[model samples]
Target: MVERYAVPDHQWDMIADIVSPPQKMGRPRRDDRLMLNGIFWILCSGAQWRDLPERFGSWKTVYQRFRQWRDDGTFEQVLSRLHLRLRQDGLMDLDTWM
Candidate 1:
């Protein structure tokens, strides 16, 4: 069954566009939220990959994508963008966050 770790709309809305895979002449990207949720589930549940809920697709796929994002700096880009937005809105203080 689908679980709570599946990213809800509001949380996904914040990072959705940025986290989406870049479109190319290849397989259409899987839902970014699903993948993110899969990652979250693993981190939050602290389970073996084989234990990943099937609703999240194969754990290997999620693992590969997570590794890809980490290696390619996608996480940094997302953080940078979020920081910029928060700074513009006076919502994020590095002093407090750091």
Candidate 2:
């Protein structure tokens, strides 16, 4: 029996709700959520993508997804939206002299 890890429902829902629907493509598709999460883990942890754990799935898949998101502007959009929300919520401090 393959064990499936549970991504926090709120976090998963936030990502699903914020991200644009995967674009329609002619080719058969591969799972994107695993790849996106793997890439995000690497970025958040400041670790090498190749060092991503097997539990996260293939490093190549994550790298490919990262590149695709970059090319498609998805990553930028997500970051921009997050920044905007943080600013609106007063969670982002812009004070330079601390």
Candidate 3:
């Protein structure tokens, strides 16, 4: 069954590199995939920060990471990369009507 707010494996694989970079320090990072799910959940649900469900990890960590990415332009970078990927795959039609 599909979990709410979870990223699909296929879709995640396409943009994982852009959104979830390998952190090169102290210890291995928490699962970026799960953190992303938590991020999407908050944004999509419009839930208050304290209300975040625990399965996705500490809401505090997720929120902090979200802010970091937003400030760093990673979101824009990911969108551009995904758009390019879609174009390459012919999934995006650039027809005049579109």
Candidate 4:
């Protein structure tokens, strides 16, 4: 079975560009989807960053990326885009989520 909290491919596709654009320079970035799943795993498990799984790579790296995304409002943009997409598809009803 798919991991309960893992981000699905479709959803990942939706935010992949925003999270890591193709024009980025330097050595290739760490796997964004893996980092994202690491973040989600921590959030869902309510665990400390140090407790992150080895499959997700270094906990420090994931934590740093999380901080960068948060401080840069990247999370906000991702959520906004997801909300819009779900709303347009009649999949999300904000009233119920409240």
Better of 2 and 3 by TM-score: 3
lDDT tens digits, residue span 44-97, model 3:
999987788998888899888789888999888988887788889988876732
Ranking by lDDT: 4, 3, 1, 2
Return the lDDT, model 2, position 80: 75
TM-score for each candidate, following the candidate numbering: 0.79, 0.63, 0.83, 0.87
lDDT of 1 by residue, 1-86 (tens): 44577776775678877788468788787777788889889999899888999988998989888998899988898888889889
TM accuracy, model 2: 0.63
Candidate closest to the true structure, highest lDDT:
4
2 or 4, which is superior by TM-score?
4
Shift of residue 70 alpha carbon in model 1, Å: 0.8
The C-alpha lDDT values of all candidates are 0.83, 0.69, 0.84, 0.90
How far residue 60's Cα lies from its native spot in candidate 2, in Å, is 1.1
Per-residue lDDT tens digits for candidate 2, residues 25-75, read 777445666666677678877889889989777888778878888998887
Clash count per candidate: 0, 0, 0, 0
In model 4, the runs with Cα more than 4 Å from the true position are 93-98
lDDT score for residue 75 of model 4 = 98
Model 2 spans > 4 angstroms off: 1-7, 17-28, 93-98
Q: How well does candidate 2 score on lDDT at residue 64? A: 81
Minimal lDDT window, size 10, model 3 = 89-98
